[model samples]
Target: MTGLLVHSARLITANSPGDIRDDPTGWVRIRDGIVTATGTMEGWAPDGDEVVDASQIGGPGAIITSGLVDIHNHGGATFAFDGSIEEILQAVDAHAAHGVTRIVLSLVSAPPRALEAQLTRIAAARGEQPGILGAHLEGPYIDSDRCGAHDPAALHPPEAHELARLLATGVVQQVTLAPELTGGIEAVRQIVAAGSVAAIGHTGADAGTTLRAIDAGASLLTHTFNAMPPVHHRVPGPIGAAAADDRMILEIIADGSHVDRTIVRMLFAAAPGRVALVSDAMAAAAASDGEYLLGAQKVTVRDGLATLHGTSVLAGSTLTLDRALRNVVSWGIPLGAAIASATVVPARAIQRDDLGRLEVGCRGDLVIWDSALVPRAVWRDGVRIVADAVAHNRPLAAG
Candidate 1:
């Protein structure tokens, strides 16, 4: 197998807090789709079949980090997750072009039979691309009043039989629910028992009930402060409970529309490493803004803001992870924290250790960005998938 070496770039390892090792001259070696070694340029010896001098491509401030991971996304490229396999693949490609290499296909609230079909199709889609992590069911068992883009007519109280059926597919990595519903706490327990993450989302659950759900094994808060109640000093809600708990990982949209810039900074301060930046993006992401469908709801997207056809409620977002990364950084977040929130943080939120870090034995998936933080090249499994003209011409092969 051909070994590849990438040298002369800032590396955000994301293995731990304050772990950014390489500032402007570092190297990483990949063999057979796995990172075999990484270090400063001084320790590097040129012994690879393929070599890339990142500095030549992205100038003096080139940055290389593990490929961004999106844990929650409906679809992109004018395709919804409930669409056919071809549409799903197209959506995945659109996000990948924007530096999201690993993604959990999110589905909105729908009937049991429909959801089962979607899950099964997503499982098949995962087979087509190694980047498709799995499926994330974001509804059906959530609060109707809090169902942002999910169909209110499809909302249902959590039931053991239905939950068991969905988890039985073994392809579901996470399930978001309103823990305040009947049997909701037990549902959290059941999801955990089935090796699936139970996420508290789309709910009117008070802080007390939200904490109870967390204790019952709910470890993720989906799209924090969006579908749930706000934090009131007298009546704290799920966002407040999640912020106080170290075990909970809060998912933030970071699109500047779904979440305010100040609140985005505050969540990072409150939860620190617990904040997972996700693009709760719908079909309009990476495409022109117009009318779109989110599950059964009619959505109209105007100037990149998506809302219900006739109302002001946000349906989803026309956001990509790369933009989310830049948004947080522009909002005064530390560079390391912003990168981790887009990469390792979301990977850990879904319990994926093989992704989100450029460590030895991790997948050789990374993004090379110019000084402006825009991705100039993307690599997945040791193969460059997307690259600009400069990146294509800058590979300095060393024998």
Candidate 2:
């Protein structure tokens, strides 16, 4: 485990530092927990304490890339992130097997006290759990009319005192709130000032309001096209504004049911590397179909698509990042572009440069995939998390 050589891969290289692309037959070397070197076998040899033959597992279709970074996730394995610390890491482990090596745990809107508890606990555990990047406060500051799957009663406008308490916890990485509400732009300003990425979501904003929020430092759009108003010829909502602004990063579900493949392609064409493929995944991500709760509202999962129990309002998703990569590729995007969406794009969105790359001095977190892009192995911080990727791909026990 001291040093390992992983070569003969579809070596994914960053096209120009941040624009990631793929080249056939890639190789990487890991010394300790840092990426020591990476390149193809033009004039080199494969030698290490333990040599991993990528071709031995999947013939000529072996693809290796930086592990997917999920900047938005609720929970998986039927365990909600709002639970205790033990449950949170368990849920993260479930997604880890599917190539989601890092995560920003997202919490749905809740009461002020409950949110404070969640934030404090997560902040305290941030350093202890390397997989957890931070907590995303998908808030009580949303537009009630568009509160998809969130309890309307729990949804409220932003307050200075509440924002102060949450920010003081020091674990807030991003906050998703409706920008059309009263003081919405000001809230965006506050969030950005406190060093957290402000995001616009569940809003009834027109293009003008969306632009103002962007001007006010709102740099991200959460789960585009689901809770917000749809694009129109006259009243283009946040989606149009995001498309217009190159600085804004948009998050897409890419579960095929939440957004159509045609729209996904259009989004890629519209934004290029600005799209951060996020799994706004819920409790049933890697588990069997059953009853789950996305925040206080009950959710039902039948055939891996989660929604409000009696209604058609889609509640998060049961998708993993690897599946998202596959879904995007199915939409005809190049493999490099798709990988960028899942890796560097999301890392840049969160401003974590240390992740989502295979360069020297970067953390040795990478995923080895088979011919179809399904993960066959996963490593985090130079440590193997999944002993056998094929075994984890099987149907997991329902939590």
lDDT per residue, candidate 2, 40-129, as tens digits? 755346554467877776467888888889998999988888988888888988888888888999999999899989887787667678
- Which ten residues in a row are the worst by lDDT in model 2? 390-399
Off by over 4 Å in 2: 15-18, 42-49, 391-399
lDDT of 1 at 193: 96
Q: Write the per-residue lDDT of candidate 1 for residues 238-322, one digit (tens) a residue.
A: 9988999988999999888887899999999988888999989899888877889999899998877889999998888888888
lDDT of candidate 1?
A: 0.87
lDDT against the true structure, per candidate, is: 0.87, 0.84
User: Which stretches in model 1 have alpha-carbon errors above 4 Å?
Assistant: 17-22, 389-399
Each prediction's total of clashing residue pairs, residues at least 3 apart in sequence or on different chains, is 0, 1
